[model samples]
Target: MAKMVTKSILMPAALAAALDAEARDKKISLSELARAALSDRINLAAIESRLIARLDAQDEAMAKIIALVSSLEAVDEPEGGVTQ
Candidate 1:
């Protein structure tokens, strides 16, 4: 098991009141609420990072496809401008 450590943080009075109100509204202790909030934020950041990486990969793939398409030469017209 990991050891738990206690730390203190200072916030503006208005923010502190808001956090306290939220914890009370949820019927949880302030410590628990803060922990949950921090965990949620960390999870959100990880998700955002993965989304960005996937988007970048897609962009690279599309760029390659565009380059391949642009490199191809146009087909010549059929003789007499008509096909049999």
Candidate 2:
């Protein structure tokens, strides 16, 4: 097991009520639900950042490939524009 420390967060009544309701609906403690939700959101944010960075890095390469394809000579339709 990993060592853990307890922390407390304060929220508005409406948000707290919503979280508590969700926790009850799922039959889990509010603490567990909040932990899982918070962890998932943080992980998704990090993954999104990494994905954007990778795509940005490839932006130039992708543009070059597109330009190369566009610069290719267009071929006319062969033999009545249809063939068996």
Candidate 3:
């Protein structure tokens, strides 16, 4: 089991009320709900970061591919004095 430490956070009253209601509805303690929510949010952030990085890498690769294709097309073009 992981060691747990206590932490405090401040939030708007409305948000706190919502969290309380959710905890009641789920039949869970407020601390447990908050811990689970925080864990889920952290995980989601990590996934989003990885997704953004992948998209950036893909964008770079596409740009390189487009440049290569353009160069090839330029090479394939006939001189201005000729047409086909």
Computed on alpha carbons, the lDDT of every model, listed in order, comes to: 0.55, 0.53, 0.59
Q: What lDDT tens digits, residue by residue, belong to model 1 across residues 1-84?
A: 111111112123434565676678779998887688787832434444554565456667867887777655223445465456
Q: Which stretches of candidate 2 lie over 4 Å from their true place?
A: 1-11, 41-84
Q: Which consecutive 10 residues in model 3 have the weakest lDDT in total?
A: 1-10
The whole-model C-alpha lDDT of candidate 3 against the native structure comes to 0.59
lDDT of 2: 0.53
Give the TM-score comparing model 2 with the true structure, all chains together.
0.34
lDDT of 2 by residue, 1-84 (tens): 111111112123434565676678778897887687787732434444554454455665766787877655224336465456
Report how far residue 27 has shifted in candidate 2, in Å. Answer: 0.5
Candidate 1 collision pairs? none
What order do you get sorting by TM-score, best first? 3, 1, 2
lDDT of 3 by residue, 1-84 (tens): 111111112123434565677678778898887687787832434444554565456667867999999888888888783376
Cα error, candidate 2, residue 64 (Å): 59
Which of the two candidates, 1 or 2, achieves a greater lDDT against the reference? Answer: 1
User: Which ranges in model 3 have alpha carbons more than 4 Å from their true place?
Assistant: 1-42
